[model samples]
Target: MKLSRATGTIATLALAVGLTAACGNGGADAGPAAPVSMDEEITLTFAWWGNDDRAARYEKAIDAFEEKYPNITVQTQFQSWDDYWTARSTEAAGSALPDVVQMDAGYVRQYGATGQLAELDGQVGVNLDTDGVDETALASGQIEGRTYAVPVSLNTQSIIYNATLLEELGMEPPADGYTWDDLVQWFADVAEAGAEHDPQVYPVGDMTGNNPWFLQWLVQQGKAPFTDDGQIAFTEEDVQAWADLWAPLRESQAFFPAKRAAQLEPKTGLNSAEVVAEANWDTLMPNYTAELGSDDLELMPIPTGDDGKKMYWHSGVMLSASASSAHPDAAAAFIDFMTNDPQVGEIFGTSKGVPATDAQKDAMTIEEGSPDARLLAYEDARADDVTEPAPVPVEGYGEIEVEMARLSEEMQYGNLDEDQFASQWFAYVQDTVKAE
Candidate 1:
């Protein structure tokens, strides 16, 4: 069921549209999408969250898009993750979001339900061709039977390790079918093996503070984080259980110290070589390899649970058009080009993530022993392991995730115990979700 919200957050747009129970053609009568005229020239504003490398890739893609459609011009801008949200939220308040924007699955429901995003189903057959896309990946962009965004790529959580470190310690990588207890023992082994090294090499980075990993843990336990209607399905006890899972690592100093982690701003144990392993998205292997200046990194899914391992395919990145934009058709056409163009696949490679469409995937040239090849090989081997459906984050999910991270940081600092963390997080969820 679609929900109506009365919160004053940017998602509501201050226009009192209140949250229309549905966002796309399935819920609201927003009329048909505006038609584009090939004869007339149009300019579109596009924005995204990323570093310079991603910006450069988007630039190339946009250039190709404009070359194909001479009448359409795209002006682009980008920012770091936090800044991107801040700027977009400000723009959302005035109903002035860019014509085209990079979207996160967590924020899609909030923006779509508030009338800030266009209903994309109207453009599907006309301007967008999804025939080459994965059905599961495409479905991830919909909520309440409405399509508000299009997934550009898909990814899943993985534990990436520095093979070089393992080699230096004369240790072998964790074998397949390793359980969570085995992983903890592995951390202890790494610590003991590297005890006499110049700079102490820890076993793993702290993943306890990451919201997505927590959700992944819940899913692995056969617990869905949210209901189909976008309400919280996990309870406070669930949160506590997640916290407890990592207590031994925290107590035994198996992970990189939180202080040291903070000192290495914008860098992580996997990237900086400060620790042997870290749990993150599989798509980040390239970045980690680049940062570590080594090609000896490896990746695998998180350790197994009682019933065996479970994971969900995630829409790593997505695109959405602003409902208030003057050039809806042009916006959608560009999105379609990005989604279906083989050249886009080549230009982006797996930098943005593994492409969501077969055409794009076919376009990639995965050289042997390359990071791209390894990432693809890993996914292919574990495709069947993804047994759960992708999550549809509830309204205010972005804010809730941020709060989760904050409380986790406090817990890391010894300011909040597991009980306090659960209580505070549930309280924040109540106010935030209730307000929405």
Candidate 2:
């Protein structure tokens, strides 16, 4: 709702819309006329996806952004995850993207490469400071050498396990140097323990789990998804190596069966019946625990290789500017004000992972005692994984991930022998990566 200029300067409460955006020439086609300077009054439409909780929180964060900066007003849009991407990609294609939208790291290459985003290199934000934010995570927005967005949060990779399950099994957690063989044995032991007690909960993985699903495995050493260039990195052997970890699990009854594993692979949300533990990014651990209806989940380092090298991949959620934005500097400034600012961090809390800055972590209401506040465990788990470099080709990026999955699936289901899969995976990856 538009507010009278007389009601000017009031705090903009997130949900309450404490004040209207300071737009001028309201009937103009542009919605809000561009201002001459950062101090000039303007209103921008900002969109994002989330459920009721995220919607409410984002509204408040927007309110906080507006209230703190009188000259700038932000109108907010919220939706579920599916709708969020649909609206973003569709509208962006039509030149109708909201002035500022939340950009996930995975899509940085996709959208940023299409010139649908703005460059965020060196931009400042309230809650985010590029310093403590893992450079690897922050770098997810870089395509070639140009930066397209800023990762507002610093989430890393690791495996999330069931602490209670460990306790029940009379087992200690996987130590830092544990290998695939160690995990195989561990799962067998857990399964036996579960049978001794409750007949239902298996020591093996729950049938429907996804994520922590694909990432850092022994196969990782065979070949990467993409190589030195922006092309595909693995051969069939690489694929088999990825599958090898789960292969034993399936054979020894340590993980879900073939059909069950397939059902759990593409999950965007976490819940029970998925798996007792799923290897995934460290940033997601807290959220997974919160979603699982219990705090039994805990963080564990990714298993190491015989050489003692542990591997993991890092992806950043970043903010990018639309190459088409006329107010590029101001857009850059807005990126700076929001993500780099501590107050903005307070408003965001762990909603996006850990705040991008240490100051925000200090001011956060998510106390150390809270399950959601367990940042230290995440910090420790990520201490060892080798962070892969981040870059992407101009197109065909989507195919790489899909092919990676396909090759992995073949290995998991025995369509390809481990040796053959590794050979093919490495060959394909070397070819694709070198081409890119």
Candidate 3:
């Protein structure tokens, strides 16, 4: 499952359409005509994947959009992350897809290549404001040099830690610019401290099966995880070394056991305070703070490489229009409102990630001492050290993500040794990319 969930804040633009303010009232003097009026009333089905909390936020945004464009009624369909892709794939096969759909980078190429998604650029009756949007983030939504989607927000990887727990154990928190060796030693020390404090509290949460963590490590080693043409970039030896790096930590109980980690929700172990630290996206910091019921959580840059570059990327959820939609204009209008409107940003406020546009970011008022503020501050501090994002993954990349998790788990549980796991994983990746 794509673990990226909706969370973030931004500002809103003034309503551009000249529709009547008597939106929901069936009255004679309802309002003026919409800026871009349709010949007939049209209904569009907008779909997305998220939890209940995200659904509520989206509902509010959709309601506002409906009020602005009375002739365009949007029917919403949302589901949990696991069920979303299954339904979408099915819909695609039948040429039946929602008009506006929430998208992720991992699946964009796959969907776009199949002609299931509409090209946003040069599309009739669609006007997207690209003026102040982050170019890097906007570029992530493109395939073969044509825009197929618009990024809703931006996020990057970070190591979130329990500052309260570290202080309780009489350990200073790791500082920015910390090295991989520094992190390893700190985890080892935390494990040792557990004996005197609470042995049940491990130093780090389990990330042995996490693809993003593995990808970051590969980037830190100065290797692209995949080539521009979508070939596997690392060698079997590289995979073995990565597996070996975690072996000692697993043996020493520095990380939660594989079984226990698997049982927990993705990225929740740190929020629950079960482990002192975990690798996660910076966008999720707000969720962690809320779940933990404390403000002591802090975001740190992921460990850097020998060249001192932090291997970071612009990551977040995106929205796209379907090629088969009867209401392409309305779909594009809704996407424009969602991405460029300040009111939507105010309502969402870091639930999706940081706002992707400069206007929205400036208009946002992150509360003092809030998780959103902390995340934004961390980004500001590390702006210079951040590297260019990796190229968008190819069509079969989603399959590789699943394979990575399976292989990593096998290595963790002793089902496969380092060399065996490396060989197997490499071969599987080669086959997957080649098939694409």
lDDT of 2 by residue, 96-164 (tens): 455566777666766776667755543434222356565665656677666777767666556677777
State candidate 2's TM-score.
Answer: 0.75
**Candidate with the larger lDDT of 2 and 3:** 3
lDDT of 1 by residue, 1-436 (tens): 2122111333333232222112222123445655566777766777788988887888888879877887887766777889788878888876677778899988888888788888888888888877776666666778877888899988988888888888899998778878777877888888888776667788886657788888887877788888778788999888888788778877776777788888898888668887888888899998789888989789877876577668777888999988876667888899999999999999999988999887998898889899989999888887877777677889988888889888877888889888898889988988888898
With candidate 3 superimposed using the best TM-score fit, by how many Å does residue 15's alpha carbon deviate from the native?
32
Q: 1-436, model 3: which lDDT tens digit per residue?
A: 1122232211100010101111322111222213346556766667788888888888788778777777777766677777788878777775556667899988877887678887777542345666666566666777767788888888888888888888888887676678877778778898788657764677876465577777778877777776554457788788778777776787776776678776886646677777888788888878888888989798878776457575565648799987766556667788888888887887787788888775667668787878888988987777776665645677888888898788877767868866787788878878887887
Candidate 1 achieves a global lDDT of 0.79
| Residues forming the 10-long window of minimal summed lDDT in candidate 2 | 6-15
State which candidate has the highest TM-score.
1
Best by lDDT: 1
lDDT of 3 at 413: 80
- Per-residue error (Å), model 3, residue 401: 1.9
Q: Which one wins by TM-score: 2 or 3?
A: 3
Clash numbers, per candidate = 0, 46, 19
lDDT of 3: 0.72
As a whole number from 0 to 100, the lDDT of residue 202 in candidate 3 is 78
TM-score of every candidate: 0.87, 0.75, 0.84
Superior by lDDT: candidate 1 or candidate 3: 1
